[model samples]
Target: MQIRPFELERYFARHEFSAKYLLGSSDPEAMSIADLLAFEPGSEEELKRVWLGYTESLGDPALRRDIAGLYESVAPEEILVFTGAEEPIFAFMHAVLEPGDHLVVHFPGYQSHYSVAQSRGIEVSHWHGNPNRNWAPDLVELPELIRSKTRAILICTPHNPTGYLFDRSSWQQVIEIARERDLYLFCDEVYRGTEHDPADQLPHLADHYEKGISLNCLSKNCGLAGLRTGWIATKDRDIYNRLATFKDYLTICNCAPGEYLAGIAVRNMPQIFEQQRVRLVSNLNLLAEFFARHTDLFSWQRPRAGTVTFPRYLGGSALEFCDWLVAETGIMLIPGTFFDMPGEYLRFGYGRASFADALARLDAYLAG
Candidate 1:
C-alpha cells in the first residue's frame, strides 16, 4: 500500500539533532540509561544478562505483567507489546481496518491516527476539536459520524498538540457511543500520566470498554524514549491475538534491552511520573507567563494535561515565523502544517530539562 509521508516525524528528523534548544519535544526530560537502571537495585546486572536473541513475540512475561498492573481490569495475557506506539497503530489499521471501512478519528491529532487508514482508501470522518472551546471534540457529533462500515473511533487523551483532556462525562460519552455501535475505540494514551492535575485523570480505556484498545508507551510518561517500547492493553482476546500474530512481519518482539528498561520504568511509574509532574507544572507556569506577556503575539489556553499546547501565532505565517525563530534563537517549534491543522497554529512542547533555557531564548526573541 502507498503511504503518505509522516510530516511530524520527518520534521523532527531534520531538526531534532541540530536544534540548539528543543522546545517542541513531546517526551518529558529523558534520563541516561544509568539513571533508568538506578531505580531498581541489581538492574545493572540484569541489563548485562538480558538475552540477545528474539524475545517472546507477545512480550517478556515479566514486562507484560508489569504493564498489566497499570490498568484496573486488564491482565498480562491481554497485553500485546510492540516496538513503539507508532508500530501498533500501523498494525491495527492494517490487520483490523480494511479499505472502505469507515474510521472516526480526532482531528488535529497525530497524523498517523487517520492518515494510514486514509492511505488505504478507508473512508474517514474527522471528529473535529473546537478551538472555540479549548480544542475539545464535541461528543454530540459522534452519532452523526457513525455508519455501517464505521469500524473504529480513534482518540488521543491528554492529547498531542492541544493537550485537551476529556472530562468525566465527555469520556463516558465516547465509551457509550462505541459500545452502542460496537465500534473499536483505539485510544492513544501515551500521555496518560502527564496530567497537570491529578483529579483530572480519566479511567483507563481498556479497563472501561471491553473492546477498547489502550495504547501506551514508556516514552512519554516515563521519560524513556530510547526504550522504544509500547504496548496495547485490552480485554478483547481476538484483538490481542490478531495484533500479536501481526507483529511477526514487523518487529517480532521489542528489543530485549528496551523491554528490560521499560519493565523497570512501568513498575516504578509513580516515582518517574511524580518527577515529571513537578517539572511539568514549573514549565507550564513559565509558558503561562510567557503567553500572558505576549498575548498580542500568541493565543493559547494553558493545557490541562500533557506537555504540549497548540497556540495560534498572531504574527504572520506560522511556518515562516517558526523558521525565523529557530534560525535566530536556535530553538525549534513544530509548525502547525505538520499536523494539517489551522495555518496560524504551532505545537509548542515544554516537557524537557532544557525548557527553562529554551523559554528564556523565546523570551529574548519576543522582547527583541
Candidate 2:
C-alpha cells in the first residue's frame, strides 16, 4: 500500500526536539511517570511489583476495565488498545475501509482523519466546519454527503486546533445519520474528557451507535503522552477482531513499561483529569486576555476544549511569522499551513507555563 507523509507528524519530527519553548503542542502539561505511580496511597509498593514482559496484546485487562468505566456502556473486552491514537486511526482505516469505499470526514481537522484514507484510494468527502461560525460543521450538510458506498463517517469532536465541541443535538444528528445509513461512525474522542462543563461530556459513540468506534488516549486529558497508550472502543466485535489481528503486524503489544504506567494513569483518571482541567481553564483565560490585547494582529475565539487554538495572523505567511518569532525569541508556534491551512493562521498552544512568556516575546517582536 502506498502511503503519503503524515504532515503534522513530520513537522513535529523536524522541530519538536530542538524547539526551546513549544507553544504548538496539543497535549497538556505532561505528568511524569513518577507522578502517575504516586497517585495511590500504596503505589510505591505496587510499582515495584510491575512485571517486565510482553503484555496482553489486547492490552492489560486492568487497564481496559478502567478505561471501560469512563464510558456509560462498554465492556473491557470490546476495547482494543494500540500504541497511540495515531496507530488506531491507521489500523481502522486499513482494517475497515476498502478502495472506492466512500468516507465522510470532518474537515479542517487533524489531517490524518482524511489524508490516510485518501492515500488508500478511498472516496473521501469533507464535512466542512465553517470558520466563520465558531469552527462548527452543519449537521444538515451530512446527509447530502452520504452515498450507497459510504462505509464511514469520521469525526473529531472538541476538534484539533479549533477546539469546537459538538452539542447533544449535533451528536444525535450524527448518530441518527449513521444508524439510518448503516455506516460506521468513527468518533475520535481524544478530547472527550476535557469539556468546559463536565456535563457537556457525551456518551461514547460506540455506546450510542451499533457500528460506532470511539477512539481515545491517555495523551490529551490525562497528560500522559509519554505512555503512548491509546485505544479503540467499539461495540462491533468484527472491528475489534480485525484491529487485534492487525496489531500483530504493527506494534504487537504495548510496551511493558508504557502499559504499566498507563494502567495507573487510567485508574486515577478522575484526579488526573481534574488537575489538568483546572490548569487548562486557567490557561485559557490567560489566552483570552492575550488575544484581546493583540486583536490587531490575531483573530481567535476562545476555544471550548483542548489545549490549542488556531488564530489568524493578519500579516505575512504563518511560516515566515513563526520562523521569525522562533529565531528572534526562541518561542515556537506551529504554522497552520502544516495542517494544510496557511498564510493567515498559526496554532498557539496555551497548555504550558511558557505560553504567557512566549506571548510576551511575540508582543515585543511585533512592537519592535
Candidate 3:
C-alpha cells in the first residue's frame, strides 16, 4: 500500500539525535536499565535468564496478565501485544477498515491515526479541538461528523502535543455517540497515566465500553520507550482476533527481553509513574513561569495532562521560527505543521530533565 511520508517522524529523523536539547519530545525522561530493574528485587537475575527465542505472538502470558491489570474488565486473552503502539494502529487500519469506509478522528493528532486509513482509500473526517476551550472538542459537533459509512471514532485522550484530556462527562458523551451509531471507539491512551492531578484520571475505555479499544504502550507514561512494547486492550473478541492476525505480517512476536523488561515495568508501574509525574510536574511549573514572562511572544494554555503543549507563536510563521530556533540555538521545538496544523502554533514538550536549561537558553536568546 502506498502512503505519504510521515511528516513528524521524518522531521525527527533529521534532528532528534543531533539536537542538543529536545524541547519537543513527547515521552517523559527515561530511566536506565539498572534504574528500572531496581524496582523489582532479583529482576536483574531474571533478565539474565530470559531465553533468546521467539515469544508468544499474542504476547507473553505473564506480561499480558500485568497489562490486563491496567484495565478493570479486560482479560489477558483479550489483549494483543505489538512492537509498539504503531503496529496495532497499522493493523487496525488494514484489518478492519476498507477502501470506502469512513473514519472520524480527533484532529491535530498523531499522523498514523488518519494517514494509514487514507493510504487504503478510506475517508477521514477531522473532529477538531477548540483552542479557546483549552483544546476540548465540542461534543455537539461529533454526531454531525458521522456518515452512513462511518465505521469508527478515534481519539487520543491525555492527548499528544495539546495535552487536552477529556473529562468524565465528555468521555461518556463520546461513548454514547459511538454506541448510538454502533461504531467502534478507538482511544489512543499512550499518555493515560500522566494526569497532573490524579483525581482527573479517566478509566480505560475498554473497561467502560464493550466496543472500545484502548491502545497503549510503555513509551510515554511509563518512560520506558527503549522497551518498544505496546498493546491493545479490547473486550470485543472479533476486534482482538483481527489485530492479532494482522500482527503476524508485522513483527510476529515482541522482543523477548523487551517483554520481560516490560513485565517488570508494568508490575511496578505505580512507582515508575510517580517518578515521571514528579519530574513532569516540576518541569510544568517552570514552563508556567517561562510562558508568563514571555506573553508578548506567545499565547499559552496550561495542559490538563500529557508531556507536551501547543502554544501559539506570535513571531511570524511557526515553521520558520522552529527552523531558526534549532539552527541558531541547537534546542529543538516542533512546529504545528507536522501535526497538520500550520501558521502560528508550535508544540513544546516539558517531559525531560533538561527542560529548565532549554527554556533558559530560549529565554536568553529572546532577551538578547
Candidate 4:
C-alpha cells in the first residue's frame, strides 16, 4: 500500500546529520553504552555474548518483562516488540482497520498517526487541539466527529510539537468515549517518561483500557534511538495474535544486540528519566526567556511535556524563517507545515546538550 511522504522524517533526513545545532531533534541527549551501563555490573559482558542471531519473534523475554514493568496492568505476555514505534503504527493500522473504516486522530500532530490509515482509503477525521487551551483537544467535539464507521481513536499525550498532555480527568473522558462507542484506542506513548513533572505522569493506556494499544520505544524518553527497538502493549489477545502473524512478512525478529541494549536501558529507566528531566526543565526555562525577549517575533504556549515547542513565527513564514536561520546560523528548526499545521510555526526541540548554544546563536542571528 502506498502512502504520503512523512514530511517530518523527510525534513530531518536532509538536515539532521549536517546541521551544526540540532535544535529540531525531539529525542533527549543520548548516553554512551559505557555511561548507560556504568552502574549496572556485568552488562557489558552479557552484551558481548548476546548472540548475533534472530531473537524471539515475540521479543526477548527479559526485555519484555522490563517493558511490562513500565505499565501498571500490562504483562510480559501482552508485549510485542518491533523495529521501532513506526512499525507498530503501520502494523496496527493495517491489521485492525479497513478501507472504509473511520479513524479519529489528534491533529496538528504527528503525520504517521493518520497517514497510515488514510493510505488504506479509510475515512480519517482530525480531532483538532485547542491552542487556546494549551493545545488540548475538546472532549465535547469528539462525538460530533464520530460516524457509524468509526473504528479507532488515535491519541498522543504529551503530544508531539505542542507537548499537550491529558490530565487525569481528560484522559479518563477519552477512555470513556472509546468504551461507550466500542472503538479501539491506539495511544502513541513514545514520550511517556518526558513529563515536566514526575507527579504528572499518567497511567499507561494499555494498563487502563482493555483494548487500548500503547506504542513505545527507546527513542524519545530513553535516548536510545540507535537501538531501533519499540514495542506494543495491549491486553487484546486478538490484536496481539494478529500483529504477531503480520510480523512474519515484515521483520520476524529484532536485532539481538539492540534488544540487549534496550533491555539494559529499560531496566534503568528511573535514572534515564531523571537525567532527561533536568535537561528539559532547564531548556524550557531558556526557551521561555528567549521567547519573552522576542515577544513581537514569536508567540507560544509553553508545552507541558515533550522536547519540542510549536511557536508561531511572527516575523515571517516558518519555512522561510527556518531556512534563513539555518543558512545564517547553522541552527535547525522544523516548520509546522510539515505536520499539516496551517500557521507560521516552528517546532523547536530543546532537549539536547547544545540547546543553550543554539538558542544563543538564534538570538545573535535575530539581532543581526
Question: In model 2, which regions exceed 4 Å deviation?
Answer: none
- Cα lDDT of model 1 by residue, 167-265, tens digit: 989999899999999999999999999998888999899999999999999888888888899999988888888898888899987799989888889
Q: How accurate is candidate 4 locally (lDDT)?
A: 0.89
Each prediction's Cα lDDT score? Answer: 0.90, 0.84, 0.93, 0.89
Every candidate's CA RMSD: 1.1, 1.5, 0.8, 1.1
Give one digit per residue, the lDDT tens place, for model 2 in 27-136: 88887767887787777687778898888999999888988887778999998889989999988888889989999998778888888898899988989877778788
Q: Write the per-residue lDDT of candidate 4 for residues 1-368, one digit (tens) a residue.
A: 68999998888887765679988889989888898777589888887898887789999999999989988878999999999998889898888888999999988888988998999999899999887788899999998999999999999988997888899999999999999999999999999899999899899999889989999998899788888899999999999998988888789999998898888889889989899989999999999999999999998888888888888889878898877777767899888878898468778998898899999988887777
lDDT of 3 by residue, 191-248 (tens): 9999998889999999999999999999999888999999999999899988988888
In angstroms, the error of model 1 at 247 is 0.8
- Superposed model 1: Cα runs more than 4 Å off: none
Measured against the true structure, the TM-scores of the candidates, in listed sequence, are: 0.98, 0.96, 0.99, 0.98
TM-score quality measure for candidate 4: 0.98
Residue 322, model 3: lDDT of 93
Residue 68 displacement in candidate 4 (angstroms)? 1.2
